[model samples]
Target: MTISTEQVQTAGRLWQEHRQAPFPDSLRRAEFGGTDVWVLDLYTAGCVLAWLDNDGILDAENGRILQSCIEDLARVIPEVNDPAGAQYCQQLHQLAVLISKNLASTK
Candidate 1:
């Protein structure tokens, strides 16, 4: 199943509890723009979406590895202090995962 961008945005808005390590923290609060939140969500959503869209395009084994790579990349959440970059990094990581998954699930 594919999640729409709008839906993701809503989910992000609803989310209140700040995420912890390996989920996009940040080097500094100012860096991530107040505790690395939105960016993380964006990244996560992107990863999933990308996988769904690209996984199939890649070969079986290659696709799977790609998915795994994306997953790994998205795993590390910057530093708690670096909120400015943290959020963005998280979002970008998510996109990586999304793309990876999409590429790996092809028949």
Candidate 2:
């Protein structure tokens, strides 16, 4: 599979879905889709995508930054009241893995 710009755009949009939060509170546990939410899940997904965006998996430290970005998105998007939040999050994650593998194999 090819890593399309659409994938990157989607990932970027996901990150900026909720950009108005102050700071630390940007990634927190709250009710999403009427269920309990956790930033860790979103963080994991975002890190996966960021790894793909960078071409492949990071060594170590930068991977943490990717995770943080996802965490931040999770904290904020829910506040935007998107009902499909979880679904979009999962797609971004799967796309990230797909993109990483696709780009890595081509290298």
Candidate 3:
């Protein structure tokens, strides 16, 4: 799926808005609307990271954040038990894998 320029801008806004907030304390038991919030957040963040990287806007700090997002998703994947949670986890994993490959190629 293509991320529009507006979506990339929104991702940048989201990153700046939340970068300094506390790491999600709720990750250990986070859920909402029958889905894992951490997974959802990571999916969005991962997309933003990829978009930023593609647009030549990703800095080292942002790269670290992206890596952290991937790690966070990996850490929580085993905890997800529901079908919806599993789907989100799978999507996140695929995003992370693709992003990692893309980043590697750009290096």
The numbered model that scores best in TM-score is 3
Where is model 2 more than 4 Å wrong at Cα? Answer: 19-49, 55-107
> Which residue segments of model 1 deviate by more than 4 Å?
1-56, 78-80, 100-107
Report the CA-based lDDT of candidate 1 relative to the real structure.
0.44
Better structure of 2 and 3 per lDDT = 3
lDDT of 2 by residue, 1-107 (tens): 44466655555564555332222332244554453345444555555555545645353554554445444445545464444554554444444444333342222
Candidate 1 lDDT over 1-107, as tens digits, reads 45456544443432322233344333323233243344435444444444334423444555555455445434445443456554655555554444553342255
For candidate 1, the 10 contiguous residues with the lowest summed lDDT are: 12-21
Candidate numbers, best TM-score first, in rank order: 3, 1, 2
Return the candidate ranking by lDDT, descending: 3, 2, 1
Show the lowest summed lDDT stretch of 10 residues, model 2.
18-27
- What is the per-residue lDDT of model 3 for residues 1-107, given as tens digits with 9 covering 90 to 100? 33457655654564565554444454446764454666557555655655565753444555666666676666666776765655555565555444444442232
- Give the least accurate 10-residue stretch of model 3, judged by summed lDDT: 98-107
